[model samples]
Target: MNQQLLSQVMASCVNAPDWLMKKRQLAVLLQERFKSTPAAEKIMAAWLANPSLAQLEQSVGEQTNADQVKAAGLHTTGWVNLPLFTAANAYPELLQENLMEKAISWQDSQLNAMHLALLNGGRFIYIPDGTIVKEPIELTVDCSLPNYHNLVIVGAGAQAAIVEHQTATGRQPAYFGTELLLGDGARVDYYQSNRFSAVQNHQAVRAYQAQHSVLNMYLALFDEHDLTTDFYANLDGQGGAAEIKMVTIASGQQVQDVQTQILNHGPHTVGNIVQNGVAKDKAVLNFHAVGKTERGAYGANSQQQSRILTLSDECKGEADPVLLIEENDVNAGHAASIGKVDADDLYYLESRGLSEHDAQVLLTRGFLLPVLNQFPDQKLREKLVDELAQRLEEKHE
Candidate 1:
């Protein structure tokens, strides 16, 4: 263990509670299992020297109450990864004995003193064929830095199904990056949601699916004061299917840039995307859907759709759908629309003895029901709905 690195990380997160400090220590310990390359060392050094911890904590305090985090609940199961760099080689030995492996990569560059970087941490998860998980697996990342880099990788085997959820919280402006890989004949359902109080930044999500695999993703973004987000999806497997959906509500001068890329690399593949955006106050929302069919992707089918509803006169919304086809036998289509609430729909509901507020709520609920109903966890779904309702109330007021 490098005491200097430990001391630096500890000092940078001085305000964090002892429990979180212990968690970081555990994470650092787990880092030892993988062979550290030069790039990994440099990234670790930058992570230790991260300068935005204080600002992130302050921002988190302003946007989210501590009680909410505590109430979110924490559950863990199955084979847990222990810290890698402990005096007891027991953990590392267990990993080696079990034939487990990990991967780490990082990229950093600066132009005219402006920083651009990408950091990725991934664990190779090998589930035996036909393995099934009843409880969802969780990966929580708390980035405390300005100009950040993050990535997560999940691997599954044939006939395997896993549910993974990721959450990011804190202040400090950051650029978040993510990539997911699924194997042949495997299936994965992923859920990710983000909330930012006052961070100015951008984020991207990318995934690659293998033969006969299925990937279903659900994403929700709320409250990113003056921030932008870019999301992407790619399907590379034959007889594979990809379903992507996102819901975003931006207020208070925030700007959302949402992009989706679904590429068909195999025959008989299917891809679809549905995105909804709502903006209030001076916020701006930009939605882009791009579907590409490669030359070899004969008999592939793809469709993309985007919808935006503006609630305030000062708010702005943009929707663009693009399709690229190189195979004559492939089927592809795109649709996009940007508009406000329909006055007739509101009037009809009001005529049924519903108040304006109730009518608006009904409209909003109708817009989000398609995605919300797909959530298997009722508790989590209700929590998300409550959060959305609170944000909507704040926007209307």
Candidate 2:
């Protein structure tokens, strides 16, 4: 990274939160740790180089129409949250209230640090304590850029649901990072879904929950070429709970790597992770999950399950689930499996008149349907199913 480019990016971050400034400073020291620019960073740089909105649309591919956003009662933003934070928008009151002091830390790794240092602008969404937001807040990354770092703070007793996405664009690979801070008694339902054309799509999430809080996360991948998510949750307060679910479908040499870790820091904390995926063609899907009970978390309960079903003889699927228990009073377990579709179930579906290929598609869809069903929005659910169906059909063809 050149000094001039770094200075220019920093100049754009005027009035950035103090913590973010410190993080940027720390990033310089760790530059030697990471040798190359992350793939998502490259895409962001491309979008940044061409700032015209029209050209951006062409390069990154267009997102949902404005009409669809309005019909769904959603809020839309063209760039990442950075621009929103840099400029005073209509929601100044909300922005001022929820803007965290510092978003990223030196602990987030070299790639995340590089993203933070290079991000020109950022977006913020703050849910005040005790307030309930029924409608999901939608963020569309239609225009590629380096605005990957986002901060979401849910105050004590607050409740909200957020659906974030990067529409399938063949042009640029994208990277996104989010820090979710849930105050005591807060609750949040978070969903991240992606479909990109032969480009790497990456997201890193770090979350913390206070006492009696609840955090539910959903990851959905449809026809992704290369997908990677590093998700970590910290249950730091007693009675806190965290649940993560993921569903993915890969075909034609697509590669996916998903890692999730849950740490119980307080007694009586509960955590669960579950993922289901389908691989066809020469596609490969790999899952890694960890459930940990700390020494002082006497009553912590943790579990993880990772399952991948394969439809093609050439496909590859692997699931690795790990459990770490440091306290005797805590309960923890993990289950992992990779296998072909059930022969009996395939036969049963085939007996009903479906062709062999059709049977595989039907059963594959059924295997991953459970995770999608957990979404609260029926519209989103239907849309995801439609996309999944399209991806499945591609395999059949």
Candidate 3:
């Protein structure tokens, strides 16, 4: 690591505690393990020259207060009330060990300017081996600046399960990036929901899974915004499994681009992806899912599916599912569909004395329930369902 870069990172973290400063120093020292890839260098440089803590504190203070934000019926909890501090304190050991083991890497070539900023921004999380945390962990990323970047890293070990919820609430144009690593025999369950009002930008996430590990992710995007999300997972150990499910609702000139990839590198690995999207009022959504199996990954099984429901003549949706198989013994397939709701299904529901609007809402809720059903926390699941209902009402109105 360059002395100039070290000095820059040190200066940027002036307000951070001594322990965090030490962690940063350790991260810099560990960066040498990865080949000096361009992406890695860019991430390191940006982190070094990142803004000072005082500046971030002031920015947080100057943001629109919780009581001032207005988005449909969505209410804002105070910054302190959000789970930022708890998330920061929860996973230090997990991330530190991954950083030490060279199991994590960064790529700037795939990053946009906002991504670069997000990489330099936000808090960090880590989870160690045999940690069985049942409570869902939640965090809110509020961007007060016109353009900002935030990055979160999670590491899970053997027999570990974790749930994370991230929400973004603010008016500023923003970029967000997240990278997660699951160690051998680890089990992780994760969920994220994003709602943006009067914003234009993208959000990206990438994760890597090791041997005998399992990962499940649920995502939801509602309201008017332009978003591009990229997700990549590498199954590096035999018997590893990855499941990704997403639901997106868009209205009023919103556009969303989704790209996902699952790579099978170990024998007998398994991967599955399921997604549902709805576009209305001139909204457009593009979704893609890809599964790739290496030659050595014999007996690997991968399946991907994407379904979209269009509610307006002016709305458009595209679904793409791709499979790349290098081993003849592997099992891999993809399914995709983009269309309007079934008129016959609606007619049948209407015959049961349900109003058209009520029927539509009921059907939409049913379409999303499969993903929500995977949540282990009953309280969180109910809260999310209520939020979804509120957003759906806004769309109808």
Candidate 4:
């Protein structure tokens, strides 16, 4: 971490917990002052150079209303990453141990020391055994920093949905990670929507499932100057299944990379990933989906599907979906494709008396819009639609 930049960011820190500082100190020691990995080095450089947070602070005069945040059934933190409100009064109680650590740490350590020291506090949602929460829980994060350690736990036989929205102005940098665990027979649906402009964003998701549980995730990344997301899951429970679906729209020098991996350790476990991306202007996008079924995990099933629709000749997109099966009894497969909007379709729509712009927009929508079905909530679906429209309206190549 850059010392001067760290001081500037820390200036906004509010009512931070005591344990937070203690963990941060330890993280500082483990901070690997010289990042050995190229990726870590690049991330650190971005954090140091980002000016989004300071610029946002100068533009927005007032903090968002706490009541509105809570009323919307959101567990949210302010720009400084301090817990500002929790909807349904699901506060400290629901935010169990930093399962970002594990089931019973009772304290924070250096494992995530760097982020602990950099972030305010994380969102924690723990679902009890056999408890079915029909209404989806929404979490709103109004952060400008680079670390958000969020966790979700679904007890045995329980079912729940979690929707997370990250909104910020400017193309600065936003980096965060989420962790989820599902006990035996549990079912969960996780969805995320990011609304950022011209940013260098890095996002990560880690999940573990117990026997006979099911986990479904839907994510929408509107656009950014540079964006990367990594998804990791482990099917540790027999008969457990995981599905990840994602949609992205990028334009104007944007770069996007989304990768996923599933470690199959339980017999009869299933994992699948599906993603659709739209590239305009000179943007670039890449997708890597990997499924590895360890030996003895018999009867495993894995699949992947990915496609990219490039709007301009200058844009680039690639998809690499791979599966490594160590068990002969398992079923695994993948499909990927990249193409441009059909000129014949556009011409036919134009000959029907529609404007050229309208024809292209309609075609683009037809190609990339169906992914919205992944969202379970109508309101969320509408919200994402609006955001997508704004991004698509930007200048195309």
Candidate 5:
């Protein structure tokens, strides 16, 4: 960790609440204690070599144009959007939620602390009780500024969809963290898409679902550099449910590590994870899916499926699916695979008047279609499909 920058950010927290300041201090202390853990090792190295706070401040000072925001499939309407810094000030009651408290883990404490201490720009969104949002809420995230955090809350019986688009056009180390709280009976469809070419992205999204609540998460990652993503959902109340679907492409020399986990802490809860990835050239892609049922989570159901397709001999991939069930009444299962495209399928397509490159692209899309079809937004689904096709075409051309 950069002690000089850390000291500067901590010193600048004069305006933060006493509790928040104390939390930041504890986060720093935890960082020092767990810096040597496996999960913290690679993340800390990435941060220590990343750009300084001064560069991020300058980048955040710049404005984002409408064209860039529109390209991410988002608009500036229909959502209650507030700057993350003063969100609690506008709604003083929100301070009672204690955001990020449940999302913290001993494994990633260092990176979590870094985000808490150095967060620069982000948004806060709240959905009230009994409200049903017809249109999806859209937000554009500029990744050039680095550490950006988002806090979203959905009240009891409320239902909504949120789309977050991250855009990075240049070389930078980017961190995007989200903490979502869903009240009882609330349903949320959260979608995130990444358009990064030169940025090394470190992203995390943690959600807590209350009784009878449902959470559906979709992730689309098409990056040309290293990327690390951690998505976790906690079913904290009886009958809560969560499903996570992810599609990604890692080409060139990129390295991508994605982890998805669902923790069943309530009776009759359901959790599922699905992921698909295509790796080409010298890229390396890894997906880890974990489903854990707590001791008293009776009648819980946990399932996961992960698949990876390698398009080159030089490329490497791993699909790891794990299930840990502590309750006898709970059900758990997992499936994982890492393999190359089929030569026979390619030959058949070529015989049907398609080029080899086109055949490979078609097959890859077909492999990912199951998860893609689950996206609730048709326009966002089309956008992801187009992006996937474009990247595949670029690789084959």
Candidate 6:
């Protein structure tokens, strides 16, 4: 939060582009403007007040090596990938076209501004126009020192898939921001797995879609920490479509606030949001899902479903679904609920000779089945299912 430390961090980036520097400066101004604003969520107040600004400052002058980055699971093949800061400094042309112009908004929140100003590590992935990538781009994050901010761009008519994993680490504060921009007719299937060891983690993902473009985002969160996530999709061009689905498991006294927003701003656009979460062992989970159809968006459609199941008496959960319809020609509706597991289903499973714990695990999986079915990769679905079962059993034991 000190000016001297911020200056040192900015100076550490060697030969960074002037435009990028201007962005950093704008972020600082935004941070100042929102300093007095309270976090929207009460649970995140303390964490947002001191969200690892010092950690980002400490990362100044540190150099990343091929070996270290590989150890962190950052090096990948079969796609155009580069270190985030390195890409900004060395290859500005790749990002100059549409970096923050549409993907991210610095004026959104103080935390967002701080993220851009203190960003020190991440990856940039680019998919050229008309290219069809047969395999999903795989990425992992293990090093938490570098406040990571990733950017991904998909050119017109391109189709690609991306999967990112966050491995366990220390009990440190961590921040990650990823913005995806899709050109006209582009299609992207993006998935994220959050299982990091940070005591407090802040994450955000935003997508900007052009005409006739499509974006599907899937999030599997199992972080046993205080976690706040912001996921958004903007259908900015005619005929654009976007769907966001999230499945989260909160256990061991964890607190999670997950917000997903979709805006239908173009004619004939479509947007959908589905979120499911399970809370056990005194954990708390809150889901906020919003679907909005802007004015002049004739024939736009928006729908959302948010549900949460609390498995323990001490555990708490909330599902808040909001719908905003500005155009009379639009169609929008939402469903939200926070409830306990169904007893009849559990009884039926137990009658089939399954133990109570086994039956509960199966029921949990079934609750998340809707979102699971939306994943494009079958292998990933199986993997996540197994991981979920194992984690549930471990927590119960």
Best by TM-score: 5
- Give all TM-scores, in the order shown: 0.67, 0.80, 0.71, 0.78, 0.87, 0.86
Angstrom error at residue 140, model 4: 1.1
Query: What is each predicted model's overall lDDT from 0 to 1?
Result: 0.57, 0.70, 0.62, 0.68, 0.76, 0.77
Clashes of 3: 5
RMSD of 3: 9.3
Off by over 4 Å in 4: 1-23, 31-42, 48-98, 102-113, 169-172
Worst 10 residues of 3 by lDDT: 70-79
By lDDT, the better pick of 1 and 4 is 4
**Stretches > 4 Å off in candidate 6:** 35-79, 168-170, 344-356
lDDT, residue 71, candidate 5: 29
Off by over 4 Å in 2: 1-4, 14-22, 34-84, 87-106, 120-122, 168-170, 343-353
| Model 5 residue 163 lDDT score | 91
Model 5 bad stretches (over 4 Å): 1-3, 36-46, 49-51, 54-79, 104-108, 197-199
Off by over 4 Å in 3: 1-114, 117-120, 141-163, 344-356
**Candidate 3, 253: how far from true, in Å?**
1.2
lDDT per residue, candidate 1, 141-245, as tens digits? 444444333223333553323333333454444455444556677677777665443345555556667788787877777655554554555667788888888
TM-score between model 1 and native: 0.67
Candidate 3, 175-247: lDDT as tens digits: 4555667777777677676555434655655677778888877776654677767777788888999888888
In TM-score terms, candidate 3 sits at 0.71
lDDT of 3: 0.62
Give per-residue CA lDDT, model 2, range 111-179, as digits (tens): 565555555344456666787877787766653453355678788998888787765343545556777
Residue pairs clashing, model 2: 81-122, 81-123, 82-121, 82-122, 82-123
